[model samples]
Target: MTIRTAVMAALLGAALTGSAVAQSGGDVGGVWQTQAGDANVRVSKCGTQLCGVIVSLRDKIDPRTGQPAIDDKNPDPKLATRSMIGVHLFFGMKPTGANTWSGQIYNADDGKYYASNVALMGPGTLKVEGCVGALCGGENWSRVSR
Candidate 1:
């Protein structure tokens, strides 16, 4: 083949490959329901990395106060009074592989941060795993909105 033709073919091949890789990664920006179906989080790009924030809760009212639930469990005393809704629970998640990301997830229930891995199981499902020391647990979250 002529040198000009070969160069054109290489450029075309690279473009196609890049497009395929981007598509395979699958966008995780959306609202997802936790496995227990008690909470919903919205995932979106926060600067260069991805972050997830609590958007809704099945039990919205604080049992003790009969008011909206607050982040009473937060380690920071000042932040403890902040509402749980719209709290960023996951942060610094960057794509690690096709459909996978690594980050930190904050567990409001325990008032702790854990090493977390997130993966898109399918177009509509996400698997979120958090590890503390040697113990790890994961839950499948369904996409609630895009």
Candidate 2:
């Protein structure tokens, strides 16, 4: 009877520890540097989902204007003059998997929004994919400190 009680307690403890690990497995909140090191985005909870904003740029000056870059390529006239800083790269990113989120990603370089998904490849790596029609490509983004 004593041995059986001890075994049951051990099993229960293991199960509880596993649950704690599971809870931390899906956390994707942090700053991530783009594969090209062109930009860094800060991702966090928007409402119920997640969103990322442009926090910095490697080249702050736009050669065309010889000043800080703006979203001149954006189709909307109102947004054309908007500054590149604080631009929403992705919003309404819904959880598609335990370690992935799917949504649209804004590309300021081309002034287009592509179907995209982000997944955690490891503790310090994230895979970001963008698709145009049938052609899809992705790159690994490294997690960065705030």
Candidate 3:
């Protein structure tokens, strides 16, 4: 009877430990960089998995023209589109594995949709690869302190 009790306790402990590991995705919370810019991203579970959301944007300047990144594709040409600020920008994301994620990425600049994937290169860096149909582009972004 004593041996049976010990075995049961051990089994219960193992199951509990596994549950905890699955809940935590090996340290996945912090300011992660993306191809667009440094974004304050919150990594958390959605339903039974994990995802990230953009909380901030860094260097609102457009790297290509050294000017402000503006949304010029709005049908309402009279709407004074701001440099940065919009919803449905990064609607949702899903975790793929160790620092990798896949989801829809909204391009505020051109008002286009692209299938996007993100790879956290390090605590201070990340790689964002995005594709539209057969065309794709990628870039590395550095994390912001905030």
lDDT of 1 by residue, 46-132 (tens): 654668999999999988999999989888999999999989988777666666777899999888899999888887999999998
Ranking by lDDT: 1, 2, 3
Candidate 3 achieves a global lDDT of 0.61
- Can you rank all candidates by TM-score, best first? 1, 2, 3
Candidate 2 vs 3: which has more TM-score: 2
For residue 84, give model 3's deviation from the true position in Å. 2.2
The residue ranges of model 1 lying beyond 4 angstroms of the native Cα positions read 1-24
lDDT of 2: 0.81
Give the Å error, residue 67, model 1. Answer: 1.4
| Ten residues in sequence with the least summed lDDT for candidate 2 | 18-27
- List where candidate 2 sits over 4 angstroms from the true fold: 1-24
Best by TM-score: 1
TM-score of every model versus the real structure:
0.81, 0.78, 0.54
Of models 1 and 2, which has the larger TM-score?
Answer: 1
Model 2, C-alpha of 120: deviation from truth (Å): 1.2
How high is the lDDT of residue 102 in model 2?
A: 77
